[model samples]
Target: MLRFAPSPTGDMHIGNLRAAIFNYIIAKQKGEKFLIRIEDTDFSRNIEGKDTEILSILNLFGLLWDELVYQSHNFERHRNFADYLIKHDKAFYCYCTKEFLEKKKQEALDLRIPFRYDDAWAEIQKKDNPKPVVRLRGSFEPISFYDEIKGRLEFYPNELDSFVILREDGIPTYNFACACDDMIYDISFIVRGEDHVSNTPKQILIQKSLDYQKQLGYAHLPIILGESGKKMSKRDSASSVSWLLGQGFLPQAIINYLIGMGNHTPVEIFTLKDALEWFDIANIAKSPVKFDLKRLRYVNREHLKRLNESEFSLLLQTQDITIGALGKLYLEEASTLNEIREKLGLIFSPKDIDVTYEGESFKEECLKLFEVLWGMSMQGESFIEYESFKNEAMKRSALKGKKFFKPLRILLTGESHGVDLNELYPYLRFYFKDILRIKGEK
Candidate 1:
């Protein structure tokens, strides 16, 4: 089985989503049961509804799981395993007070060395009363495991010491619960970020101490870096899935960009279904991939271009093909749905003629054009061909070249510079009655 374990402490990170994408796709390819584990054991830090938010994001991307397990639900079993370790002399309870441990840590700091707990008490047959927490009797030998991505990895015995398993409040720590739950859920393969590499040997030690020997597969993928060449952080607005959605990015575009980043693909653009056919682990780049927002915008534009006429209209939340055609025209100017909407809004909103263009004569020509178009629309000409409107308007103000077309663009689109007026006029011509409605026209 494969699992995606997430802690609901805050908004989901892009890296966490990457992990989910990889695990879900791999599980589908291998015909294995995929599970989602909400690792909310640290109740102190978990947000109230962050788990539901995480699951909803997964749903948005179509990553359905075969099983859903909450780590907190297995508290009883976790306590039992801790006791089993105590009975087998593999773990022990320590009476060391907080002050005592702090003193030991202080000594290590003063000596400029690492602090390690005394494991001499691990083998004591006599049980101590009033102990605060349970700790593992860590092994003194080397620890190693074969990783699917990073290859065979090894850690020295000094790298780990006697660490807490069951806390004073009887709750299992992260590594302890993760190891226990993996065994309980029959999860043989674990794929997560490279940040978890240090915890592997510690979890392995716990499994070994409990006499549960299973070969676990791991793929610690390199994390995503921002365009600035640093680790992606929460402060980066692009790191949030909700932010991306709010910016009007299509879900399939996001999936394609993520899977296609740092990997070889059959085509330049594809859908999630397309990825299911060709995704291979070997093709993934071993180095960290950068999140290029510009490339993502280009990919979104490509996805938008693939929509049929009906699909395009539906995506704009309109049944009118004019809006869809306008969307196509503005696709050259913008990428996202929100951007297209913004550009379309500019055409209908009132234009500010107070701003100057080249000089007084240029501004005069623009006002003259607006006056003629407003007059044409008010005369109830519901629609007119582009050539007809231009011929009639140019007859009144015999301006040509930059003198005529520049002001004409300003009058038509409410911007001094934008898409070609010829291309913008067809769908826009249909809206002329709405676009040129000046109340006090001369």
Candidate 2:
């Protein structure tokens, strides 16, 4: 069994989605059970709609899990585990107030030494009856564990303080809740980001104290860095899955981009089903993966090209009529659906098309060229094809180069460059002729 745990604090950024993909793919490829556990014990920071959004995103990417568990549902179990620790002398409650701990922390800082709670608190607790916070009694010796990604690692228990299991607010801390749930849920494997490495030993200590000696596999994935070479964050707008989707990125394209991040595969364009055949833990790179938008756009464009005519048309229709009509015109020219939409918008919603003259007879020649092209189309000639029209227009107008095509391009698009008028010729002819007739320029 494997689990993908995420806190419902905010929308999942790109890195979060990638981690989920890693765990999800591994589970499916191995024929094992995959589970989703919402680590929502930190209720103060939980956003209202984040939980639903997380599940929606997972479904959007086709990451279905066999079971769903919410941590808050097991609050009683968590409290009982803390009490069990206390009964077994593996943990104890300390009545130290916040102010008292703060003063002790400051004194330790002044001495330039690390602060580990003196177990002397345990001796004092035997004589006093005071409301207290439960703290786990970690071993004085070093704790070691094997990591699938980073290999073997060791940590001295003294490097950490006797951390809290149950806060004074009667809430279980994250490590405690995660440890208890992992064991109870029978999770055989744990996949998480490298930042969680520090918490592993503490969880291990808690498990050992409970006399649960079964060892599970752990894989701490490397971090994902942004374009600036720093850790990806929400402020980096492009790093957001919602933002990417809203920009007209297909879900498969996003999945491909993320899967390629650590998989180190040469196959650029692939579907999620295709990826299932070769997904392996050995292929994942230990180095941090860089988030590159240029590569992502290239990947999206490749996926777009693979869509059949009906699929392409349906996707366009879902967005807008202009896109549905003009999308195929510039399909090859666009790297993203957003690019196609923007181009169609420019054609349909132009502010103005200013005519530029390269010669004294440019306007006359251009209008005459348009009339000839329309006449040829009406006469059932091949002028509907841009190449045939351009050849005929050049011969008939006795014009060459930009003096001929540039004026026509500007008149149709109101821009210097865009989807080649050749590919756009059929759609543009009727629309342009209607506009010319309406404006009395025909």
Candidate 3:
């Protein structure tokens, strides 16, 4: 069995999404039962809709699970486990206040020493005192575990603070809450990011104290870095999955890009179904993976090219990039939806033609060409005869190449270089009169 547990505190970061993907892939590969556990015990940060949003995004990527569990729903079970530890003398309650701990931590920092918990309060009894927080009575000896990815890892229990199990507010801390739920859910494999390496030992302690019979295997994937080799942040491009989706990125592209990070494969373009066939746990890379926007764009382009015409049309409609008959044509030429949107900018928001030529005085020639095109359109001609238009313009003005097409291109699309106006004539003819009425068009 495997579990993809996420806290509903904020938008699902790309790193967390990758972890979920790894877990889901392993679960499917092993034919094991998969579950999604919502760790929403932290009332302070747990937003209302974030849980739904997390599940929605997972579903969008086609990562499904067998069951859904909320960690808060098992609050009584968590308390009971803590009580069992307390009865076994494996944990104790500390009456330390926040201010007291902060001052102690600062003093340790000033002394350039580690701040291990001085659970001295366990030896004393102060009746009528404030509520106490339950703490694990960790050993002074070293504790070790074998991680599937990182291999043998060791942690000195003396160096680790006797971290809180339950707060005075009767809320279980993350380590305690997650460990209890994993035991309850019978999670056999624990896959997470490298950042959670430190927390693993603490969780192991809690798991042992609870007497979970089954052994838990762990695989901590390498951290994902930004292009600058630092941790990813919102300032980075496409850092937020929701923002990426809103920007018209297909979910398949995101999934392919993420899987490609760790997998050693010759192929760049692959679907989730293809990924399931190729996924191997041993193939996951140990080095940090860097997030590159250019690579993501390449992946997006590949996915765009794979979409059939009807699928492409539906995608455009869903994104509200409707351009009538021209949209389908643009989709054929565009490598990405963003590219289609860029090319269709003029159609969406028409601008006055900037007919200011660099030096040539070809306004008269361009005006004659427009006059001919408008007359033909007004006569119910829906298509442009490019050769005929060019011949008449050249015969009238004795101009060709850049001098001839450059000015007309600028007038047509408000730009000098873009989609060939000759091929775009069928669509641009509807806007020919509108382009001719621009203030600067001669």
Candidate with top lDDT is 1
Global fold similarity of model 1 (TM-score): 0.91
After best superposition, candidate 2 residue 23: deviation in angstroms? Answer: 0.8
Winner on lDDT between 1 and 3 is: 1
Can you write out model 2's per-residue Cα lDDT over 141-164, one digit (the tens) per residue?
998999888899999867766888
Model 3 Cα RMSD, Å? 3.4
Candidate 3 per-residue C-alpha lDDT over 271-309 given as tens digits, one digit per residue, 9 for 90 to 100: 888888887766778888888887887788778777665
lDDT of 1 by residue, 289-389 (tens): 99999999999999999887677788889999778887877788799989988877778776656676655445577777877777777787654567876
Report lDDT per candidate. Answer: 0.84, 0.79, 0.77
**Pairs of residues at least 3 apart in sequence or in different chains that clash in candidate 2:** none
TM-score to native of every candidate shown: 0.91, 0.87, 0.87
Cα deviation of 317 in candidate 3 (Å)? 1.1
Q: What's model 2's lDDT at 320?
A: 37
CA deviation > 4 Å runs, candidate 3: 123-125, 318-335, 355-367, 382-399, 422-442
Off by over 4 Å in 2: 122-130, 318-333, 355-383, 387-401, 427-442
Clashes of each: 0, 0, 0
